[model samples]
Target: MDVACAFPTTLDTPDNIAMAESLGYVRAWVYDTPQQSPDVWMTLALAAQRTERIGLGPGVLVPSLRHPMTNAAATATLAALAPGRVSVAFGTGFSGRRAMGYGAISWSFMDAYITAYRGLLRGETVEWEGKRMRMLHPAGHAPARPVDVPVLVGALGPMGNEVARKHADGLYVTFQPPEFMREYSWVPYLAWGTVLGEGETPDSEHARLAGGPGWALAYHGAYEFGGPAAVLDLPGGEQWLAVVERSPAEERHLAVHSGHCVELNEADQAAWDAGGHSILTDVTISGTRDQVRRKLDDLAAHGVTEIVFQPCGPDTRTELERFLDAAGSHLKPA
Candidate 1:
């Protein structure tokens, strides 16, 4: 399987992309949460100038955040800079919209947006708000006529998967195991956190701490949108819900959006402790190197083509290097 690196649009993103390229990662996907990170397109522009071999683009840019015309233009501009290396994935906003106190964009809106955006990319005129529009003066350096950029769709639910199956080149999924790939035949790109070490087992405390932040993200997503019943099936769902129940109702939102890593407040930490190793194993790639290889083998067996590794913790670069040391051999060159 090919490996990609997903980065928050922090100031150091270009450097991170360069480093990942040097370490043999095939792609660098930047996040599009404007409230929490830099503009993804701008960050990717810097990445294009900084790295030569790695694929570069937004991991999943939210369609609701920009007009179809704006997205089409920006994508064309990026393709001018990086050509075949540029690809885009569209998603119904989650953190990007939630952080703004809004909900996900309706699928109807996304459906229309994708149709228009894809048509625009192909140098065809598309009907927009009320009028027809097209890229009148395409960049000479951009990929020709049928702008060969790959379009991926981020999906979690059945409806979203249907949208992807109908309109996109592939699907980007998170927190799903290999079995999911078998069910969905689209070219699959899986993203998950990685916290493997030389000798620590999946059940080791060190492994749990390394992987806990990612597990917390999954937990928070279910807690915020799916409610108590949605979380009940998870390993420590009951205990996690109880801790949230104890918190001031207003402050619960703050707890869920706490900084990227797993450094939760005392109460949150207690809940995390309650989840134990099973929680970490569920959402992250954690275990000894050999164990992680087995997991990768399983994913490959089930048809996962690309694996995007999301490195967490205070020292993200170090965490990334650790992952590279353990799995770099599996990364095919771009």
Candidate 2:
């Protein structure tokens, strides 16, 4: 399977993107939570200027965050700078929206937004929000219209999957088994974890720093979707429900997602201290080099075309370098 790298929403990410290019990752995708990090397209433009071979795009954009025309133009801008190296994905809001005190957008809304976005890119006057609009850029203003960057949909269930199958060129999913979608040739599975150091355990300080975010995200996502019951079962997950429940309901959203993928906030830290370590090693793809290589092969066998690994920690450079060493060289950069 092709190996790709996904990044947290941090401005310093372009430097890491460059590292990925030199190390031969097929694509470099960045998180698009505007409240948490730099603008997605701006970050991508910086990455475009720094790297030539690797692909770049937002891993998944929340439709509610911006207008279709805005994203259409941004897509064109990235296409102009990176040309064929650009690919974009849209989602019904995961972190980007919840952190802002909202839930996922409806698939029907997503269907219409995607239609308008794609239509705008084709240089067509598309009707959206009761008005018609089209890209009217001159040559050199933005890549000439009909910019053909691949579009992916961040989806999980049948409704979202149907939208992806019908309205997008690819699929972007998080925390799912490697399952092939027959309708599309592109499937990007979002994953996390670290390569264990010699004699290292999953609960080691390095492993927690490198992969704790993935496990914590489980609690945050579960609480958001199904409440405390959803999260109480995971390894240190029981601690998070009570912690968030103690907060005012209106502010609970903020409490759940604070620190996000960057570090463990107070509540998340409590959970981790309680027993969150095993969740990281258990759910995330953590192991030694040979073990990780075999897991990657298993991922490919199960229909994962691309493994979008998101590394965390203060020393992102080291984490990324180690991941590349484990991914081997078969996955060439775009």
lDDT tens string, model 1, 1-334?
7878787688888998998888778888888888778798889998899888899989788988898878888898888888779889888876677656567887778888999999988889999888999877645645565676888888777787678777888777765543444554544454555556665555565554556666667666776688768766676667767776765766665555555433444434555666544666556676666666667777777777777777765576776777766665676766
Which portions of model 2 miss their true places by more than 4 Å? 178-183
Question: lDDT value for candidate 1?
Answer: 0.73
Alpha carbon lDDT at 153, candidate 2: 92
Score candidate 2 by lDDT.
0.83
Clashes of each: 0, 0
- Lowest-scoring 10 consecutive residues by lDDT in candidate 2? 175-184
Taken over the whole model, the C-alpha lDDT of each candidate is 0.73, 0.83
Q: What would the TM-scores of all predictions be?
A: 0.85, 0.95
Off by over 4 Å in 1: 138-146, 177-188, 198-210, 232-254, 260-268, 275-278
Q: What is candidate 1's TM-score against the reference?
A: 0.85
> What C-alpha lDDT, on a 0 to 100 scale, does residue 318 get in candidate 2?
81
Q: Model 2 residue 110 lDDT?
A: 95
